[model samples]
Each structure stands twice: as C-alpha cells, then as structure tokens.
Target: MQVNATPNRRLVVGISGASGVAYGIRLLQVLRQIEVESHLVMSKSAQVTLAHESSYSVADVKALASVSYANTDIGAAISSGSFPALGMVVAPCSIRTLSEVATGVTSSLLSRAADVTLKERRRLVLMVRETPLHLGHIRSMASATEAGAIIYPPVPAFYANPQTIEEMIDHSIGRVLDLFGLETSLVRRWGT
Candidate 1:
C-alpha cells in the first residue's frame, strides 16, 4: 500500500456528530493502509453517534489513528499552523462544526485545528453530511469556501457501480485522498 505520501506527511482528521460516522472510520483505515500518518480528534457528540452508527468502540476508532487528541485539548500540537500537516479533513462534518469553522469561532480542538489549516493556506476539506440543507447551511458553506476551505459533501458516485457499501465507502475516500495528492486504487476510475 505504499503510495505518494511521505511517511512524515501528516493528515488531521476530525470526526463530529454526524450520521455518517463510518466515513471517518473508513478514512482512517485507508490512510493506514497507504502508510500515511493520521492525527485524530473527535467531538464528544461524535462518540455518541459512533455508538449509534457503528460496531466499533471509541478505543477501536482511536487506535486507527497515529495520534489521538482530546477534543478539549485546544492546545494540542495540531492546533497550530506550525504543526505542518498536509491538511485537515472533517469527515461527515456536523453542521455545528461547519458553523464554527465558518465563523472562525472554535470551541473545540477539532475546529481550532481546522482554523489553523485554513489560516496557514493548507488544505481544509469538510465533508458536511447534513441533508435538506437550508439557506443557513448554504451560507455557511460559502463562508468556509471564502476562507479557503473546500466543502466536499460525500455524495456517492453511482457511476462507479459499487456492489457493496464498503466499496462505495472506499470510492468516496479515495477521491478525498486525491485532494491531498495521494493515489489509491480503491476507486474505479471512469476509464483507466
């Protein structure tokens, strides 16, 4: 699984309270397989969502990442622009988290790190997962974009013709990793 990323290149992963907890989990798994280091932070609400959505425990999820930071640890290493990560991704980002990032009002380390990524001109991808979006959600997404963050909703690529949920998950993740210049064959390209 060795790939484009250097072993030292780090990616910050934030998991918020969204229905699609599996997205974050699978992202970590894929990162590990490709030998990319991962730093993980989870909102407290994400723990609750994980219990409702997946069979894995918090410990199980935490184990996937190279470093796990407490959401309350606002002073963690990744919270600073000097940390030199490739980027940050909030897989299945909750609306609450999106609002904070949009307003630059960070209540947790996860959001704080996201802010740092944007301020440092590094990649900041938010997988906003809420549906039936209203005007506020649309406006917040615009704000995040204006701040140099990429709003990547994890819409399924039916063109891939995924036969299983895991394949669908991998396809979505592979595309997201592509944003960081890491390549993976998990995705079925349109023409290869």
Candidate 2:
C-alpha cells in the first residue's frame, strides 16, 4: 500500500487495549481502500488483545496501515502537531487510554499523539469499548469531550439492519470517518 499521503488525506490511528481490535483493523483497511494515509500506533496491550479477539497477527494488522509507529516511540512523526494529519482516531479505546487522554497525562505515544491532535485543534475520535458505566468512566468521557475529543462508543446501529458483525463494525467506523469528512460506502444509510 502507498505510504505517501496528500496534504489533506492523512489520518492518525491509535489502537488501545480494548476488546474490539477488529474496529481498528477494519478502519486501517478502509483507509487504504479510500486512499487515505493511515499512521497506526498500536499499544503493546492492543497486540495482546488482538491475539485474543481476532485472527490477524500484529504484523498482519500493521501491514494494513500506510505507516506504523511503536507505542513507545514518543518521537514518532505523528506525535507532533506538524505531522499535518486531518485528525486522529483511537479505535476500541480502553478506559485507561481514555483516562490518559482526558487527564492529558499521555505516558505513551498513542495518547501523546491524541494530545497533539487535540492541541492542534484537530478531530480526535475515541471509540470507547466498555460497558457498565461507572461515574469515573462518565467523568473521563466528559473530560475528554471538554478537551475537544469526541467520545464515540462503538454502538451497533440496529436501524441499519446489519446482517453480520463485520457490517456492524463497518457502520461504526464509517460514522467515525465521517467526522473527518471521509466518506465510505460501508454505511447503510437509513433512507435512500
């Protein structure tokens, strides 16, 4: 896949240790199909999650992205506001990652890149993948939202009449991409 991105077509992708690793994987594949340069940063725990949740290996998922970054590489190009990405998305964002972004205590490159995106006044969509909301999780969501991050839980759109899990995943990611003005046919519109 092409790694070079046009001035307006680059996006940063961060995958945390969330259960829905397939969300991040499918997002990368769709980005490639749409000719958008994807800068991927997968947390170490995300790799472990991928092993448990999906059939793809770490290398397989990394290959889907245009550019891949080590979660510990704080100096990665995407870590800076000058990287010129349209925005960033953290698919299957874990509570830990969300809290870090909310508190601005970005210990790893994933959250740091998210912080950079926020500081740059760019869109940062967090596909939070947890249930049983506690007051703490809600507060973190509020804090992240106040900091200009969008807390997008990967909820299934039953109205879309999805027939498979892949369809549901595509719908959620497609909506997330819409926030960055990227369009995809993966979404089944409610009305014709």
Candidate 3:
C-alpha cells in the first residue's frame, strides 16, 4: 500500500454532520491502503451522524486515520496556515460546514483548517452531502470556488455501474483523490 506521492505527504480529512459518514470513513481506509498519512478531525455533530448511520465507534473511526485531532482543537497544527499538508477534504460536508468555510468563519478546527488550506493555496475539496440545495448553498459554492476550493457533491455516477454503497463511495472518493493528483484504481473510469 505504498503511496505514489512523497513518503510524508499529508492529507487532512474533516467529517461534518452530513448523512454520508461512510464516505469519510472509506476515504480514510483508502488513504491508509495507499500509505498516505491522514490527519482526521470530526465535528461533534459528525459523531452523532456516525452513530446513527453506522455501528462503528468514534475510536474505530479515529483508528482509520494515521492521526486524529479534536474538532475543537483550534490550536492543532492542521488549523494553522503553516501546516505543510498537501490538501484537505471535507467528506460528507454538511451545508453548515460548507457555509462556514465559504464565509471564512472558523468557529471550529475543521472550518479553520479548511480556511488555512485555502489561504495557503492548497487543495480543499468539499464533498457536499446535502440535497435540494437552495440559493444560499449555490452562493456558498460559488464563493468557495472563487477562493480555489472544489465543491464535489456525492452524486452517483451511472457510468461506474455501482452495485453497492461501497462501490459508490469508492468511486466518489477516488475521483476526489484524482483532484489531489493521487493515482488510484479504486473505481473504473469512463472510456478507460
């Protein structure tokens, strides 16, 4: 499970109070398989969502990543602009978290780390999990995009012929990893 990138390349993963907690967990699993060091931070509401959606405990979730940070730990290294992370991903990004990052509000370490990623000109990918997006969401997306963040909603890809939820998760995270220039064979690409 050797990573294709530099040995110490780091990726920060944030989990918000979104429906698809599996995406964040699976992304961690895939990152471990690829030997990428992961710095994981989970919001308080994200813990509730994980309990509602899956049987895994917070300890289990934390174990998936190489390092775990408290969501309220604003002093964490990942929350600083000087942190040399290659990128950050907010998988299953809740609308609330998305709005916070879009407006540059750093109420939590997750949002602050995302803010630092953008300010540092590093990649920040938001896997927005909300549906029926309103005008506010659209505006936030636009604003984040303007700030060089990529908004990737977890929409299913029919071309991938996903037969199960795991397949769908793999496909979406694989594409997100592609944005970070990480090579993965998790999902088959179209016209491949």
Off by over 4 Å in 2: none
**lDDT accuracy of residue 76 in candidate 3:** 91
Error of 2 at 88 (Å): 0.4
lDDT, model 2? 0.93
User: Backbone clash tally for model 2?
Assistant: 0
For residue 180, give model 2's deviation from the true position in Å.
0.9
Over 1-192, each residue of candidate 2 has an lDDT whose tens digit, in order, gives 566677579999999999999999999999999999999999999999999999999999999988899999999999898889899999989999999999999999999999999999999999999999899999999999999999999999999998999999999989999898899998888895
In candidate 1, stretches whose alpha carbon ends up further than 4 angstroms from where it belongs are 1-8
Question: How well does each candidate superpose onto the true structure, as a TM-score?
Answer: 0.95, 0.98, 0.95
The CA lDDT of each predicted structure is: 0.91, 0.93, 0.90
Write candidate 1's Cα lDDT for 72-185 as tens digits: 998898898878779999998999999999999999999999999999999999999999999999999999999999999989899988899988888889999999998898
Please write out the lDDT profile of model 3 over residues 1-192, one tens digit for every residue.
Answer: 332345246899999999999999999999888878899999999999999999999999998988899998989988887778788999989999999989998799999999999999999999998879899999999999999899999898989899998888899999999998788888798899
Q: How far off is residue 40 in model 3, in Å?
A: 0.4
Clash count of each predicted structure: 0, 0, 0
